[model samples]
Structures are given as structure tokens and as C-alpha cells.
Target: MKLARRLQAIKPSATLALNARAKALAASGKDVVVLAAGEPDFDTPEFVKQAAIEALRTGFTKYTATAGMPELREAVCRKLEKDNGLKYAPEQVVVTAGGKQSLYNCFQALLDEGDEVIIFAPYWVSYPDMVHLAGGTPVIVPTREEDGYAPDPAAIKKALTPRTRAIILNSPANPTGAVYSRATLEGIADAVRGHDCFIVTDDMYEKLLYTGEPFLNLGNVAPDLVPRLLVSNGLSKSYAMTGWRLGYAAGPKALISGMQLVQDQSTSNASSITQKAALAALNGPTDTITAMVNEYRERRDLFVAGLNAIPGIRCRLPEGAFYAMADVRGLLGKTYKGKPLTDSLQLSEALLNDFLVAAVPGDPFGAPGYIRMSFVTSREVLQKGLTRLRDFVAALG
Candidate 1:
């Protein structure tokens, strides 16, 4: 059996790979503290779970419309209007397996061979692979830690070429947790407004903010670009519904229809019960989300403080999301139990093997001297993990 060239070009998700390795280690009786996977540690809220249970009991097991159930689409529209300040007709929204599929649909529907998509580093690991799978080129624009890892509009403009077709924006970003300010988003929006390009905003973490900064939904911030903008979101992160496999998006009717056609040919629709649960999640009381955010905020503060207290580690206080990307360059070339720490991967392995702490290496995110630690665990686990990290680094010195 032979695989297609495109299929062969794809790489496994580094986060999941690390997580699997950590889990295997733990199963072997070695205690492992995993901070690599991105899913929230909380259980899915009771209301959302109950909705799915009710759907199952009611025999709501039939196929839904490829675009989504009308009620769910309407609920999504209401969510956009209420939370994102964007009004969308139900026809313009489509729910898929998850935000990953929504984004894959966008790339599949929009890109042609040789089209270029600008992705900022340290981007989510799947973006470039998805672009390649869609026959598009991924042009990576690197941002610095000193800049809060925010991509400058000017730099993005400089990277644009005649073949540039799209730009991806992920705020409360993965791996780095760098939230774009309203001004920054506006500048980028303004830069690409008249250009013959589309913008795909991944607002998966829109509700996970901690810094009290107003989230500027790019689609709402620049309505003129709505026809070309695709906003992808899901229930995985905020609602702690990773196993539900529900995600959605709103865009121009034409694009949504194209995506619907793709979904019809491919996934057909998200799970019927999952859609019901997602509908409940969107329409039910949002107080659980508020409570989760509050707890995450406290955890973020505690984790950031702990990371900063360690020698040779400098972590930026993340503005949103649940990650702490700490620069470990100060520890490079230092010896850890007679083994030299060379880069992020080596540091990660040393931490896991020596201190039983597991984190994802930044090399996968295009930054090699940093490591991403998720703070979505309990305060007790966070404190112990930080203590292990501190002791490990101190031993290195």
C-alpha cells in the first residue's frame, strides 16, 4: 500500500505526541505531571452534559442537516450577537467536528495551488500542515518575546506577495497565550482590508481570558472584511467538552455554503448528541464559564509567579488562555546531572525523566528556547509542579 504524497507530508501533532509519551511513562509506574495537552482539566458543565443525556434518551440519534441543526445554528448566531457583537443569519453558520475541521474546511474551500497563507510563529502546530494539505504555502512570520509575541502588521505586510491568499489569527493563542490588543487587531485588519486576501480568526479561547482586556473579535471589529473572514470556535476549550467533538463558524453565505458542501461530502455533520449539548452550552446559563475563567485566572497568577521565581527561567505573564511560555535560554549549555541542556526538547526530556514533569517543547511552535506549560490543573498540582521545576533548575546550577 502506498500513501499519497500530500498525506506523507503531514506531521503528527507534537503536543499529542508528547502527551502520549508522558502517559506511557506514567503507566509504567513513573509518576508524571503532564502539562502538554491543551484541553481543560475541568469536567464538562452539568447542564451541557445533561443536554446530551436528554438527547440520547429522546432518541435524537438521527442525522442532522450537514450545515447543522437549525436550532443549534440559531443558538450560535445568538451567541455571536451577544458575545462577539456580530450578527449572523443561521444560513451563514456551519458546525463541524471541531474548530480544526472548520479551519480545514476554510483552507480546502479557499486555497488553490501555490496560494500562500501567512502564519505567525509560534503558531498552532496544525496550521502549516493544514495549509500544505490544502495545496497552499505557509509563510511563517516570527515574532519575539519582547514584543509579547504579537505579530506586527508591518512585518506581515512585508511578507505578503502576489500569491498571498490568506492570514490566520489566533488570539489568546495556543502555546504562548498571547492575546492581541484591540489596537493591534485593528492595525492588522486595516492592513489587509483592501488586499485580495482572507483572514481566518481562531477564537477558540475567546472566553478564557484572564487579563480583563476586551477581546476584539476580528470579524466584528472589521465588518467590511466579513465577506472574506472566517471565524472558527469550538466547545473543547471553554466548555471542557473535548470528547463532544463540536465546533462552528460564521462567514459569508457563499463560503459557509461551500464549507457545508465540504462537510456534506466529508463529515456530513457533527455528532447529533454533541450538537444538542453545544446548543445547550451556548443557550444555557454562562455562569459555569465565568466560574472556570475565574479559577483559571487564579491558577495563571500562581503559575506565573512560581515560574518567575525560578532561576534561569523568564516567563511572560500571559494575558489570556492557560499557558505559560517560559524562555529557558538562560539554562542552555548548563549541565543537568552531567547532561548538557541544549534546547527546548532536551530541557523537556530532562524535566520529564528527572523531575517527572512533562511539558511540550517550543521547537514545534518555532521557538526553540522556550517551553509551554499549561496551568489548567489544580492549584496543588501547579504548586508541586513548579516546585519540582525550581528544584530541577537549581540542581542544574
Candidate 2:
């Protein structure tokens, strides 16, 4: 059997791999607390589910346009105007399977062989892989934990080379939960104004912010870059619609047309009923989102403080998103249950095997001394998991 070299080189998603292991353990009657998955633990709001049911009952199962149903596109445009203060026409948007596909569409439409995309670490695990799949090189700029994992504009400028085609931005980021400041976003936008590179902003967590700080959309901040800026978002995170598999992007009409063509050949369109559900999500009441964010904020505070209380674990206070990436270097050289703990991956596996707690290693996200713990579960589960983690690390002494 033969396979493409590009496909051969790509690695499976680390998050999903860890999740499968956790599921295996759970199947064996082990009480596993999984902190590796990225989706919110909340259920889809009732109204959205009802909308999907109604759509199916009303025979909305037929295929719409390749781009999307016009009504949904209009709803998405209205959402942009209502939330981000940006204006877009239906032609500028392309609906896809999920936020992941929206990103893939951008890569497929814009990237050529040897093109370089600048990504900040610790980034979402999928960015670099997607770039590789599209035959582009991913140039990673390492950002420090002390800097909230926000990329330095100067560093981005230094990473630029003749082959650079775009820069990827993920705010309220995965793994680290680092939200870029408005000033930093403006600086990056300004730095790339004259350059010939596109700016792809993943704002999937835009509505998941817990901090009082304002989220400045790059397109809104620098309308001059609208032609080159691509904003990707979806109902998965903010609206607890992960299983619905619906995402959309807004950009220039030409680039969006390219994405539409790619979708036409690949996915064709998102699930028709899911599209109707997403329409209700976008245009319906947003109170569920606000309530979810508030609950996550409380969990974040509780979990971060609890993790820090554990000796040898130091977790930074995350401003947005639901993850707390704790630096575990203090426990690296110690022994846990008579086994030597060496790196983040080893520590994560040990926690899962010994403490029945599953977390994601930091190495996959460009850091090697930390582990990401998600607080998407209930408060009781978070407390119990923290206790188990604390006891396990304390045993190292």
C-alpha cells in the first residue's frame, strides 16, 4: 500500500490520543477524571436543540448552496455586526464542518508549497499539522509563560522571511488560556500592514472570555487589513455545540470563494439541520453563553488556586478560557510511587495511571515542563482531581 508523504508525516492529535486512553481506563471500571478534552462540559441549550429538531421535522434535510444556507449566512453576518462591530456580506463567509475545517479551508486556499506560516507557542495542537497537510512550513515563535504566552510583535517581525505567507492568531488560546491584549493585537496588525502576508485569527473562544479586558478583533482594529485578514469562529465552544460540527469564516470575497470551492469538493456543506441549529444559536438569546462563561470563571479561579496550593506545582492565573497550564518543573526530578518522574509526558501518564486523573502534556504545545488541566468539569470533580494530584505529587517526597 502507498500513502502520500505528507499524510505519512503528520501525527495524530495529541488531545484525542490522550482522551482515548482515558476512555479505555474508564471502560475498565477505573474512576477516571479526564482533563484532556477541549470542549465545554455543558449541554447544548434547549432552544438550539429544538431548532434542529424542528428543522428535521420541516424537511430541511436537503442540500443548500455550497457556501451555506443564505439565512444562516445572513445570521452570521448579523452576529459579526452585533458582537464584533464588523460588517460582512454573505458572499464573504464560508460555512464548513467545524472550526478545524474552517482553518483547513484557509490553508488550502492560500498556502502553496514552501509557504511559511508564523504560529505562536504554546498554540493549539492542530495549527502546525494543518499547515503541514497543506504543504506549508510552520514557523513557531516561542512565547514565555511569564508573558502570558502572547507572541511579541517584534518576535513576529523577526520570524518573517521571504517565504512567509501568513501569521496565525488564536486568542483565549487553547492549552495556555492566554488572551492577547488589545495593544498587542494592534501592534501585530500594524507590523504586518505593509507586508504581503495574510492574518488568520481564530476567535473560537472570543465569547468564552472571563476577564473584563476587551477583545479587539484584528479586522475591526485594522480595517485596512480586511482583504488579508481571515476570522474563523464557530458554535462549538461558546455555545456548547461541539458535536454539531458547524463552523464558518469571514474574509475577502475572492479568498472566501476559494474556500467555498474547496468545501464544494470536500465537505460540500455542513449538516443542514446543524446549520439551522447554528442559525438559532447565533440569532437567539445569548444568555446561555454568558452563564456558561461565568461558571467557567468561577471554576478557573477555584482550580488555579487549588493547583498552586499543591507543593511543587505552580499554575499561572489564566485570564480567559478554561485551562490552567501548571509548571511542574519542581516535581520533574522527584520520584512518584517509586517511579522517577522525568518530564511533562511522564508526569501526565503517571497521574492517569496512579491517580486516575488525565491531563495533557505540555511538550505537544511547545513547552516541556508543564501540563494543561481543563476546568470544564463540575466543581466537585475539579476539587477531587486537585486533591488526587496534590496527594500524588506530595508522595514524591
Candidate 3:
């Protein structure tokens, strides 16, 4: 049996692949320090869990609406209005299996064959492939580490074309954790003023910011873009509800309807109980998130400092999220067990196989010679992983 040709252009999620490999190694009695996962180490808040329990006890297991339950959609609207300063009706909201699915739905609803979606380099590993799977071309624009991995408006403008249908922006971005500045966002808004493409902002890490400044997406800086903007968020990263599989998006009613139709024929409504739990999370206290953010700040400082202290590794301080993208170019071209370590993939393999440390290489993220490590684990685990990484680099001849 022959597979579809599209499968040839897509690769498995690099982060999840590394995580599974690390778990396999650990199950085999290897002491692997895994940092490939993007989820926080914290559990879902007790109140949220209790809400799910209540739903289960009441036998609320039947499907509701394809978009979401009205109450939850209204809760999501309230969340956007309160936190993001974006007002929307419940009609504009669509809750899906996860933020990933929300994005996938967006691409499927918006893209036709040969349509283009602009993505920044060092982006989340799933972005490019998701676009490809939707029959769209992913136009990657490289962002320099020196620029804090922030997308450049001028470069983005230059990349825009007649076929460009959308631009995906992930601030407090994954892998790099670089938050876009207000001026940068404004500039991007200005650049796209006359363009017909939509803007997709993934604010999954909005609450994990360490910077004192307020979180601002393209919508906050440019209200005009709201008409064409799709804001995707979830309870996974910020609420520590990775297993809940509840995410939502707010956009124009037409796009929401399109996404709902796509979802309606697909998974239908998300898990009924999970939606109740997500409603609780949306309306619940954010104190747990505050505590988690405070702890992650400490871990980020420790991990970045530790990475910098290692020879041939330099990591910029991430302003948000829980990842550190370390530049490992200095360690490349060195001999590892008499074979030349040429790229991030080779180096990552050496770290995992020989040193029992797991990290996602940057090649799959469109940034070679780098590796992304999550600091969501405890400081003890982070320290151990850093030490092993240091030893691995030193062992390179």
C-alpha cells in the first residue's frame, strides 16, 4: 500500500518524539532527565478537578454543541474581555480538543491548495507540518537570536504575497520564549494594514510571562486587525491542564462557523466533562498560576545561567514560557566518539543516548545548531540535566 505523498513532507513532532524516547529509556532502567515536554510540571488546580468530578457525578457525558457549550463559550468570551481586552460574543468562540486542534481547524477552514501561511523560525514544531497537512505552503521567516527571536515587520511584509492567507504569531513563543514587544507588534499591524491575510495569535503562554510588562498580542496593539484575527488559547500551559485537552479560539463569526463545521464533522464537541472542567478553570482563581509562574521564574534563571556557564553553549534569558533555546553551534564540528557532530540533531542524539539527557533539537523547529530545553521540571532535575549536558559537551573532542 502506498501512502499519500503529503506524508513525505511532514515529520513527527520533535518534542513529543524526544519525550517518548526519554520515557522509554527511563523505563529501561536508564536515568534519563527529560526536558523535551512543553507542559508545566504542576497538576491541574483542585477546583478545576472538582468541577470535572461534579460533571461526572451528574452523568453529563453526552455531547452538547459542536462549537462548545454556551456557558463555556461565554466564559471564554469573559476570559478574552477580562484578560486580553478583546470583546467577543459567544457566537465567535469555538472550543476544540486542544489549542493545536483549534489551529488545525483554522488552517483547514482558511487554506486552499497552494495557499501560504507565514511562520517564524524556531517556531513550535507542529506549525509547519500542520500547514502542510492543510494543503498550504509554510513560508518560514528566520528570526535572529540577537533580535530575541521576535518577528520583524519588515521581513514579514517582504514575505507577503498574493497567495499568503495567514500569519501565525506565537508570543512568549515556544522553544525560544521570546515575547514580542509592543512596538514590534504595532509595526507588524501597520505592515499588514492593507493585506487580506488573517492573523493567528497563539497565546498559550500568556500567563507564564516573567517580564513585568503586560502581555500584548497583535490584537491589543491593533484593534483593526481584530476583524481578521484568530486568537487561540488553551488550559494546557497556563492552567497546567495538559491532559484535559480543552482549548478555544475567538474570531469572526464566519470563521468561527467554518471552524465549527469542520469540528462538527470531525471530533464533534470536545470531551463533555473536560469542557466543564475548562469552564471551571476559566472562572477559577488564578492564584495557582501566579505560584507556578513565580517558581518557573526561578527555574528559568537557574537553567539559563547553568546553560551559559557551560562552554560552547550560550542561552538568552527567556522572557516568558518555560523553555531555553541554547545555541550549541560552538559544540558542533567537534568529534563525538570519533564521529563529527555536525548539527543539533546529532548533538541531541549524543546527549540522549550517551548522557541520558533528552532535549529537542532545533532542526525540526527551523533553527539548526540549537537545542530547546524546558525548565518546567524541578530545579533538581534541571540541574542534573544541565550537568549532564555540560559533561556531554566537554566530552566532545
Better of 2 and 3 by TM-score: 3
Which residue pairs come into collision in candidate 3? none
Stretch of 10 with least lDDT, candidate 1: 212-221
lDDT of 3 by residue, 1-397 (tens): 8899888899988888889999999999998898898888998899999999999999999999999999999999999999999999999999999999999999999999999999999899899999999899999999999988877889998999999999999998997999999988988898888899999999999999999888997999899899999999999998898988999999999999999999999999999999999999999899999999999999999899999999999999999999999999999999999999999998999899999989999999888999999998999999999889878978889
Candidate 2 ranges beyond 4 A from true positions: 337-339
Residue ranges of candidate 1 with Cα displaced over 4 Å: none
Query: Which residue pairs in candidate 1 collide?
Result: none
Q: Tell me how far candidate 1 lies from the true structure as C-alpha RMSD in angstroms.
A: 1.3
lDDT of each: 0.90, 0.90, 0.93
Model 1 lDDT on a 0 to 1 scale: 0.90
- What would the per-residue lDDT of candidate 1 be over residues 130-247, giving only the tens digit for each residue? 9999999999999887888878889988988889989999998997899988777888888887688888899999999987766777876787888888889998998999878999
Query: Which candidate gets the maximum lDDT versus the true structure?
Result: 3
* TM-scores of the models, in the order given: 0.97, 0.98, 0.99
Backbone clashes for every candidate come to 0, 0, 0
User: Whole-model lDDT, candidate 2?
Assistant: 0.90
In Å, residue 107's CA in model 1 sits off its true spot by 0.7
Better of 1 and 2 by TM-score: 2
